[model samples]
Target: MKAGSWSRLAAACLWLATAGCSARRSEPISKAELLTDKPSERGRVVFMEHCNRCHPGGEAGLGPALNHKPLPNFVKRYMVRRGIGSMPAFPQQLINDSDLKDLMSYLTALKRHERGADQTALEEINSRR
Candidate 1:
Protein backbone atom coordinates (compact mmCIF):
# COMPACT_ATOMS: atom_id res chain seq x y z
CA MET A 1 0.00 0.00 0.00
CA LYS A 2 1.11 3.59 -0.66
CA ALA A 3 2.52 5.58 2.30
CA GLY A 4 -0.24 8.20 1.92
CA SER A 5 -2.90 5.48 1.92
CA TRP A 6 -1.48 4.01 5.16
CA SER A 7 -1.45 7.48 6.84
CA ARG A 8 -5.06 8.09 5.80
CA LEU A 9 -6.11 4.70 7.16
CA ALA A 10 -4.40 5.49 10.51
CA ALA A 11 -6.17 8.84 10.70
CA ALA A 12 -9.53 7.21 9.96
CA CYS A 13 -8.95 4.60 12.69
CA LEU A 14 -8.10 7.32 15.22
CA TRP A 15 -11.23 9.31 14.35
CA LEU A 16 -13.43 6.25 14.62
CA ALA A 17 -11.98 5.36 18.03
CA THR A 18 -12.65 8.87 19.41
CA ALA A 19 -16.15 8.91 17.97
CA GLY A 20 -16.99 5.60 19.62
CA CYS A 21 -15.78 6.85 22.99
CA SER A 22 -17.87 10.02 22.76
CA ALA A 23 -20.96 8.02 21.75
CA ARG A 24 -20.73 5.92 24.90
CA ARG A 25 -21.22 9.01 27.08
CA SER A 26 -24.71 9.41 28.46
CA GLU A 27 -26.73 12.27 27.09
CA PRO A 28 -28.29 14.92 29.37
CA ILE A 29 -31.92 14.39 30.26
CA SER A 30 -34.32 16.43 28.19
CA LYS A 31 -36.77 18.98 29.64
CA ALA A 32 -39.78 17.04 28.28
CA GLU A 33 -38.69 13.94 30.20
CA LEU A 34 -38.43 16.01 33.39
CA LEU A 35 -42.07 17.10 33.10
CA THR A 36 -43.44 14.04 34.89
CA ASP A 37 -44.61 15.31 38.33
CA LYS A 38 -44.19 18.89 39.52
CA PRO A 39 -42.03 18.14 42.53
CA SER A 40 -40.16 15.30 40.84
CA GLU A 41 -39.58 17.44 37.79
CA ARG A 42 -38.21 20.25 39.90
CA GLY A 43 -36.07 17.72 41.70
CA ARG A 44 -34.73 16.42 38.40
CA VAL A 45 -33.79 19.92 37.44
CA VAL A 46 -32.03 20.45 40.75
CA PHE A 47 -30.17 17.18 40.33
CA MET A 48 -29.00 18.11 36.86
CA GLU A 49 -27.78 21.44 38.07
CA HIS A 50 -26.07 20.24 41.24
CA CYS A 51 -25.65 16.46 41.52
CA ASN A 52 -25.44 15.21 37.94
CA ARG A 53 -21.78 16.00 37.70
CA CYS A 54 -20.86 13.41 40.28
CA HIS A 55 -23.83 11.06 40.02
CA PRO A 56 -24.90 10.84 36.42
CA GLY A 57 -28.44 9.44 36.29
CA GLY A 58 -27.90 8.38 39.93
CA GLU A 59 -25.16 5.92 38.87
CA ALA A 60 -21.66 6.16 40.27
CA GLY A 61 -19.28 8.55 38.55
CA LEU A 62 -17.08 10.67 40.74
CA GLY A 63 -19.11 9.53 43.76
CA PRO A 64 -21.09 6.43 44.72
CA ALA A 65 -24.26 5.24 43.00
CA LEU A 66 -27.22 6.81 44.82
CA ASN A 67 -30.00 4.92 43.04
CA HIS A 68 -29.00 1.61 44.62
CA LYS A 69 -27.98 3.00 48.01
CA PRO A 70 -30.15 1.57 50.81
CA LEU A 71 -29.78 4.64 52.99
CA PRO A 72 -32.86 6.10 54.67
CA ASN A 73 -34.25 9.46 53.63
CA PHE A 74 -33.10 11.09 56.86
CA VAL A 75 -29.57 9.73 56.47
CA LYS A 76 -29.46 10.89 52.86
CA ARG A 77 -30.80 14.26 53.96
CA TYR A 78 -28.19 14.55 56.69
CA MET A 79 -25.47 13.63 54.23
CA VAL A 80 -26.57 16.36 51.88
CA ARG A 81 -26.79 18.87 54.69
CA ARG A 82 -23.50 17.85 56.27
CA GLY A 83 -21.25 16.34 53.61
CA ILE A 84 -19.80 12.82 53.76
CA GLY A 85 -16.35 11.70 52.68
CA SER A 86 -15.65 13.22 49.26
CA MET A 87 -19.22 14.49 48.99
CA PRO A 88 -19.56 18.19 49.76
CA ALA A 89 -22.16 19.53 52.16
CA PHE A 90 -25.05 21.40 50.64
CA PRO A 91 -26.35 23.96 53.10
CA GLN A 92 -29.92 25.25 53.21
CA GLN A 93 -28.87 28.16 51.02
CA LEU A 94 -27.65 25.85 48.25
CA ILE A 95 -30.62 23.50 48.58
CA ASN A 96 -33.58 24.54 50.66
CA ASP A 97 -35.86 22.15 52.56
CA SER A 98 -38.51 22.16 49.83
CA ASP A 99 -35.98 21.43 47.11
CA LEU A 100 -34.46 18.71 49.24
CA LYS A 101 -37.84 17.05 49.58
CA ASP A 102 -38.28 17.18 45.83
CA LEU A 103 -34.80 15.78 45.34
CA MET A 104 -35.65 12.87 47.61
CA SER A 105 -38.80 12.21 45.61
CA TYR A 106 -36.81 12.14 42.40
CA LEU A 107 -34.23 9.82 43.89
CA THR A 108 -36.91 7.45 45.15
CA ALA A 109 -38.57 7.42 41.78
CA LEU A 110 -35.23 6.72 40.11
CA LYS A 111 -34.55 3.79 42.43
CA ARG A 112 -38.00 2.34 41.82
CA HIS A 113 -37.60 2.65 38.07
CA GLU A 114 -34.21 0.94 38.10
CA ARG A 115 -35.53 -1.91 40.22
CA GLY A 116 -38.55 -2.31 37.98
CA ALA A 117 -36.32 -2.52 34.93
CA ASP A 118 -34.15 -5.16 36.54
CA GLN A 119 -37.20 -7.15 37.62
CA THR A 120 -38.72 -6.95 34.19
CA ALA A 121 -35.52 -8.23 32.62
CA LEU A 122 -35.38 -11.09 35.08
CA GLU A 123 -38.98 -12.02 34.38
CA GLU A 124 -38.28 -12.03 30.67
CA ILE A 125 -35.34 -14.38 31.13
CA ASN A 126 -37.34 -16.68 33.36
CA SER A 127 -40.18 -16.80 30.87
CA ARG A 128 -37.75 -17.84 28.13
CA ARG A 129 -36.83 -20.85 30.25
Candidate 2:
Protein backbone atom coordinates (compact mmCIF):
# COMPACT_ATOMS: atom_id res chain seq x y z
CA MET A 1 0.00 0.00 0.00
CA LYS A 2 1.01 3.67 -0.40
CA ALA A 3 2.63 5.47 2.60
CA GLY A 4 -0.36 7.79 2.90
CA SER A 5 -2.79 4.84 2.96
CA TRP A 6 -0.70 3.06 5.64
CA SER A 7 -0.54 6.18 7.80
CA ARG A 8 -4.31 6.72 7.54
CA LEU A 9 -4.97 3.09 8.54
CA ALA A 10 -2.59 3.40 11.50
CA ALA A 11 -4.36 6.57 12.68
CA ALA A 12 -7.78 4.89 12.44
CA CYS A 13 -6.52 1.93 14.48
CA LEU A 14 -5.06 4.25 17.10
CA TRP A 15 -8.32 6.20 17.34
CA LEU A 16 -10.35 3.01 17.81
CA ALA A 17 -8.02 1.74 20.53
CA THR A 18 -8.21 4.99 22.50
CA ALA A 19 -11.97 5.20 22.09
CA GLY A 20 -12.38 1.71 23.55
CA CYS A 21 -10.11 2.59 26.46
CA SER A 22 -12.18 5.68 27.25
CA ALA A 23 -15.35 3.55 27.25
CA ARG A 24 -14.03 1.31 30.01
CA ARG A 25 -16.72 1.10 32.72
CA SER A 26 -16.54 1.13 36.49
CA GLU A 27 -16.70 -2.14 38.42
CA PRO A 28 -20.02 -3.45 39.72
CA ILE A 29 -20.74 -2.97 43.42
CA SER A 30 -19.84 -5.96 45.56
CA LYS A 31 -21.84 -7.48 48.45
CA ALA A 32 -19.30 -6.03 50.89
CA GLU A 33 -20.19 -2.56 49.64
CA LEU A 34 -23.89 -2.88 50.47
CA LEU A 35 -25.31 0.62 51.01
CA THR A 36 -27.59 -0.04 54.03
CA ASP A 37 -30.43 -2.19 55.41
CA LYS A 38 -31.56 -5.69 54.43
CA PRO A 39 -33.87 -4.43 51.71
CA SER A 40 -31.02 -2.68 49.93
CA GLU A 41 -28.98 -5.86 50.12
CA ARG A 42 -31.74 -7.93 48.59
CA GLY A 43 -32.33 -5.23 46.01
CA ARG A 44 -28.63 -5.19 45.16
CA VAL A 45 -28.79 -8.85 44.25
CA VAL A 46 -31.82 -8.26 42.10
CA PHE A 47 -30.12 -5.35 40.41
CA MET A 48 -26.97 -7.33 39.71
CA GLU A 49 -28.92 -10.15 38.19
CA HIS A 50 -31.29 -8.04 36.13
CA CYS A 51 -30.13 -4.47 35.74
CA ASN A 52 -26.34 -4.55 36.04
CA ARG A 53 -25.72 -5.49 32.43
CA CYS A 54 -27.16 -2.26 31.08
CA HIS A 55 -26.70 -0.08 34.16
CA PRO A 56 -23.49 -1.21 35.73
CA GLY A 57 -23.20 0.31 39.23
CA GLY A 58 -26.23 2.43 38.28
CA GLU A 59 -24.06 4.29 35.76
CA ALA A 60 -24.82 4.47 32.07
CA GLY A 61 -23.79 1.52 29.90
CA LEU A 62 -26.11 0.35 27.19
CA GLY A 63 -28.76 2.53 28.85
CA PRO A 64 -28.83 5.92 30.56
CA ALA A 65 -27.39 6.39 34.06
CA LEU A 66 -29.88 5.67 36.86
CA ASN A 67 -27.82 7.18 39.68
CA HIS A 68 -28.07 10.77 38.46
CA LYS A 69 -31.68 10.65 37.26
CA PRO A 70 -34.01 12.61 39.54
CA LEU A 71 -36.98 10.40 38.68
CA PRO A 72 -39.48 9.27 41.33
CA ASN A 73 -39.62 5.67 42.44
CA PHE A 74 -43.08 5.18 40.98
CA VAL A 75 -41.87 6.46 37.63
CA LYS A 76 -38.92 4.11 37.67
CA ARG A 77 -41.20 1.22 38.58
CA TYR A 78 -43.56 2.10 35.77
CA MET A 79 -40.68 2.27 33.30
CA VAL A 80 -39.46 -1.15 34.37
CA ARG A 81 -42.90 -2.58 33.88
CA ARG A 82 -43.82 -0.78 30.68
CA GLY A 83 -40.37 0.03 29.26
CA ILE A 84 -39.51 2.98 27.04
CA GLY A 85 -37.39 3.34 23.93
CA SER A 86 -34.55 0.82 23.84
CA MET A 87 -35.27 -0.53 27.34
CA PRO A 88 -37.21 -3.77 27.53
CA ALA A 89 -40.20 -4.24 29.85
CA PHE A 90 -39.65 -6.49 32.85
CA PRO A 91 -42.82 -8.34 33.76
CA GLN A 92 -44.05 -9.50 37.17
CA GLN A 93 -42.92 -13.01 36.36
CA LEU A 94 -39.33 -11.82 36.08
CA ILE A 95 -39.44 -9.56 39.15
CA ASN A 96 -42.40 -9.79 41.51
CA ASP A 97 -43.88 -6.83 43.38
CA SER A 98 -41.95 -7.55 46.56
CA ASP A 99 -38.60 -7.77 44.76
CA LEU A 100 -39.48 -4.64 42.83
CA LYS A 101 -40.05 -2.80 46.09
CA ASP A 102 -36.70 -4.01 47.34
CA LEU A 103 -35.04 -2.88 44.12
CA MET A 104 -36.51 0.57 44.60
CA SER A 105 -35.16 0.69 48.10
CA TYR A 106 -31.70 -0.19 46.84
CA LEU A 107 -31.89 2.43 44.12
CA THR A 108 -32.98 5.04 46.65
CA ALA A 109 -30.08 4.18 48.89
CA LEU A 110 -27.64 4.38 45.99
CA LYS A 111 -28.95 7.78 44.96
CA ARG A 112 -28.72 9.00 48.52
CA HIS A 113 -25.13 7.86 48.83
CA GLU A 114 -24.20 9.43 45.50
CA ARG A 115 -25.80 12.73 46.52
CA GLY A 116 -24.05 12.65 49.87
CA ALA A 117 -20.69 12.21 48.18
CA ASP A 118 -21.37 15.11 45.83
CA GLN A 119 -22.51 17.34 48.71
CA THR A 120 -19.46 16.42 50.75
CA ALA A 121 -17.15 17.31 47.88
CA LEU A 122 -18.90 20.63 47.40
CA GLU A 123 -18.68 21.38 51.11
CA GLU A 124 -14.99 20.57 51.19
CA ILE A 125 -14.33 22.85 48.19
CA ASN A 126 -16.29 25.65 49.82
CA SER A 127 -14.43 25.21 53.11
CA ARG A 128 -11.09 25.43 51.32
CA ARG A 129 -12.10 28.83 49.93
lDDT per residue for candidate 2 within 1-129, as digits (tens), equals: 975455446544543554421221223222124357999889989999999999888777897677755567877887788776677889999999999999999988876665444545566679999
Please name the candidate that would achieve the greatest TM-score relative to the true structure. 2
Worst 10 residues of 1 by lDDT: 22-31
Segments in model 1 whose C-alpha atoms lie over 4 Å from true places? 1-35, 119-129
User: Residue-pair clashes per candidate, as listed?
Assistant: 0, 0
Model 1, residue pairs in steric clash: none
Q: Write the per-residue lDDT of candidate 1 for residues 87-128, one digit (tens) a residue.
A: 789998999999999998888767555434454556667999
lDDT accuracy of residue 129 in candidate 1:
100
lDDT of each: 0.67, 0.70
Clashing pairs in 2: none
Report the Cα lDDT for candidate 1.
Answer: 0.67
Error of 2 at 21 (Å): 22
Q: Which candidate is the best by lDDT?
A: 2
Candidate 2 Cα misplacement greater than 4 A, ranges? 1-34, 119-129
